[model samples]
Target: MNAVKTGSHAASTLEKTPVGDLVDGKGHSSGAEWLTRYSTSLMGVFGTPQRVLVRGAGCLVWDADGKEYLDLLGGIAVNALGHAHPFVTSVISSQLATLGHVSNFFTSPTQIALAEKLLALTHAPPGSKVFFANSGTEAVEAAFKLARRNGASPDGTTGKRTKIIALEGAFHGRTMGALALTAKEAYRAPFEPLPGGVVHIPFGDVAALEAAIDETVAAVFLEPIQGEAGVRPLPPGYLKAAREATTKAGALLILDEVQTGIGRTGKWLATEDAGIVPDAITLAKGLGGGFPIGALLTFGEQTSSLLAAGQHGTTFGGNPVATAAALATLHAIESQRVLENVAVVGDYLRTGLAAVDGVTEVRGEGLLIGFDLDAEVAPAVVTAGLDAGFIVNSPGPRTIRLAPPLVLTKDQTGTFLAALPAILRTAKDAQ
Candidate 1:
């Protein structure tokens, strides 16, 4: 028998591979056994593993058992250009080979370029500033601190307007500051004592917003479309009303575009045609096309100056690699004409879902869509979809959420529609 090498770039034989693996009777690793190991080692925050996904390409992924699925959730709207996109991978690889990262104390061209590009995309006014972070939660947390600073008095000690207003049914993030703004009781109760002085008002209700936002309010946070709450778009003129109310009350309007922005809605910004400028905006999810980057953009000196030196900092927020990946994502969105594709294919998906017998209503814009099931069988429907080699999410017991890659094609949309009838039937039969 020959000696098998382990670590240090050496290959190992079948019997010599280190631990953390399960072998069946035939001596092959199994996904089910791996799930058992995963459960034993990792916390059950997200519950049991689905398939132990191994590889992905385009709008498809394969599980540990080599089963393929058309990824409709896109990792919960994180994979903007789908998986292992060549353009993004090339940029990330090139940037990493050239300069992986530099400390925040130092800056890189990729980071600076991405900031400028994002500011331009927002059509931000002069003197706007972008604070980079690593995830959607961090971006919201940064904006939370910015709002607190805005509430501070001239000397930066006392405060006149210390309260922040967030909409009910909002899903900002899971961090303390972000969670404080989120309205879900289940998500907040376990993590009590959240950053205080946060108030929740009915989403898109002009009257509730007006009543809550007063001169003593620091900021009002709202999502253009409630992503995790079943993709409910704001009523017309709601954002305009919020802007007028906040401006009159001397409160800043912060839009959490974490899930809705970056061309997900077939627009550069979901709030593009709303005709109101947000004091600040927090963005993430699809920004890096799955590479992980978040940003807080403050408009004008009024909001930008709130975060002075040493106010907020992140170590890996704007690393050169992530920034480069983001740049590629943005460029691909444009050069690939993906926004146009989203409009055509998204409408197709929306219309198809609407035509389904079990679908009650379809809500959302562009590639981000959610539908209500006539019956309370969304989980069953999702399971049926998985069994049919499709990927979807049940955000609520009756809500099916789909935030697929922006590059989803009309053919893929047709394929999903073709398979949905049986999936819905399976759910109904189970019920």
Candidate 2:
């Protein structure tokens, strides 16, 4: 493997860094040195390695060479109870020991129970059905198909309503159908000729939304809070307006809560606060506490009957182990009172972070927080934070996002807050 070293430190690092476990009787090399092996084995779609992470516990992780970091991103909001939570481990182990995978042909008690729990949390109308998948993309794919199916003419004739309206700067997922709903050109350009029938509009513009909605549209896909676009929440009353417009136009309103759902925003469902019943909701990420699982929820008869048995299915959608993990995560979140912690500590951290030198704006609810950096040094800031034993993400050139574990305490948040000034200074110097 080639060691692309730079500067005076690079010379010593290349010579001294260990090859797997050990160098030539010197120190160990586990952080960046392991990147060569990673490049050889894995795809480069995600770009260069930040660090060689090895293991993690609640709100903290260790790298390959024993370097520790406070994991504030929480696997991009996937870890609800933080890493290696014992409750999650025990549940998975017990469920795996008993009934792991019976497939969709047969359902386990755990799977059915989790589905029912999710349905209750959403407080859907009289009848609601859930279809489980293995990731956020699959949940969205199911919702997309359901919308298309629901809008199809009864006789399967021509002139079927197949169009979907998505928000500008919205990120649904990476699949062809989901990508069509995403508005970023850079993420969509290479995957062109994608599934069509999707159009984008300015988010938070109620008038534009009303103008766009019509009977020709099948579904309106939106996020209560835009996670990838740096955790931007929907404008006040925007969800209600979307619900009204879609209902009036006979279109389904699909809320993609893959990032904001499962109490990330101090609520079981972010849409609940809006007091509007959406036609469908897509969920994943924190639902499984890092275990890959997703679900598509349909409210009321019109939406629930959209997909028939054979119309949609999954091989490992609600496998017992994944469902068990999800149940454990939910139980822990509730029993441990983690959501309260998120509400209290998240506000504290946000208030503190807003006072930092480089931060220009602070936004988000509960454990999911985001801030605008004063300069385009977000990536550099991420690097500096990592060096200072903290982990964060910069979704854009000037946007810094933090979706830490719901269990993160103010003391842990203080650690990051204390180091942020120095990290900002380093990032500015690098820029």
Residue 363 Cα positional deviation in candidate 1, in Å, after optimal superposition: 0.5
Best by lDDT: 1
The candidate 1 region of ten consecutive residues with least summed lDDT is 18-27
Model 2 residue runs over 4 Å out of place are 1-29, 156-159
Top model by TM-score, which number? 1
Question: How many Å off is the CA of 362 in candidate 2?
Answer: 0.7
Clashes of each: 0, 1
Q: Encode model 1's per-residue lDDT on 343-404: one tens digit a residue.
A: 99999999999998878999999999999998899999899999999999998999999999
